[model samples]
Target: MLEIVAVPAFADNYLWLIHDPVSGETVAVDPGDSVPLLAEAERRGWPIGQVWNTHWHPDHSGGNEAVKQAGATVYAPASEAARIPGVDVALKEGDRVRIGEHQAEVWEVPGHTLGHIAYVLRDDGIAFVGDTLFAMGCGRLFEGTPQQMFESLQRIAALPADTRLYCAHEYTLSNARFAAAAEPANDAIAHRLKAVEQARQAGEMTVPTTVAEELQTNVFVRAHDPQDFARLRTSKDTFR
Candidate 1:
């Protein structure tokens, strides 16, 4: 079976460790820091051999060099390889990354960064989204336009409802608040907000949010058009 464990880094980033017990191989995704990630790997006895990057953000690929130093190969986006410190493989859309017997489809999800990408383990119904789509929010428009972000979100929304979304940050509580603000009348958002608050109070992880939950509550994904999406993105940016 494919087991994904979340390794908290910095203040809020979630560095994922994908392990395949059958082959005893491990894959690290968007490791923002080396200290915690390497430590967790050692504690769990999962020797990481591959590192998959989603973008060139410092908070995402900052640990690439260190992970490489630990004998792991790095796989990054083809378009943004120059920005990443150490990229062993430059991948594009339709490419596949394998961990043991499991394979994940690579997609170019540009918006947070011009070369931002995401990985979907189709058979396992899991997706590792970088900074593109958050729990209830979306990534900021750093290099790409709102149109690109909107389209990218649509692509993700096309996934099966059962797909578990593993985004890079632990922003569910804040996002739930924003979701409720965006759609005041949404009972789903209200319900999620209450649940997220409780989870945060108890010091729990609010990730692995299913696609069904996002569809029912994510205002950004429910946006009807680019104009609508753009307006909402602007609102979220200035909100707070």
Candidate 2:
């Protein structure tokens, strides 16, 4: 089995540490800062052998150079290689990466950035989505268009309902508020809002949300079409 750990950094960012016990291989995903990531890995006695980047954003690939210096091979999106630091392998859609015996397929999920990608481990039923798909929201359209984001989200929604998404940030509380406003009549959104509120108030993480849960509550994921998604994205940008 793959063992995953979430390492919090810079207030909201979550850097994932994935370990495959069988192969004793460890990988760091979207490590914005090398300090916390290195500390966490050392504490767990797991030497990171690979660093997988989702995009060229500073807060996602800033630690690439440092991690690579520590002897980890760096893999980043092919389209954004020039912008990202220390990219040894440029991955595109359908490319595969492995940790121990588990393999993850690369998926182009641009929205937050034009070259953003996701790592999906089908056998494990989990996906490290970077900033593309959040718990109840999606990434801001920094370099991609609403149409592209909508298509990316639809691809994610098509995954089995049980698929667990590990997004980069903890934006669930604020996203729930927007979701409630977007679908005031949705009992699911309302109920999820209440739950999210409690979780945040109690200082708990509300991520690793399942596809089924997002389908029922995420306004963007529930959008009727690309136009609808565009409106929701615009609203979220100005919300609160």
Candidate 2 positional error at 213, Å: 0.5
TM-score of each: 0.99, 0.99
Global lDDT of each candidate: 0.93, 0.94
> Candidate 1: where are CA atoms >4 Å away?
none
| Per-residue lDDT of candidate 1, residues 38-92 (tens digit) | 9999999999999999999988999999999998999999999999989999999
> Which digits, one per residue and each the tens of the lDDT, describe model 2 over residues 188-230?
9999999999999999999899999989998999999999999
Worst 10 residues of 2 by lDDT: 62-71
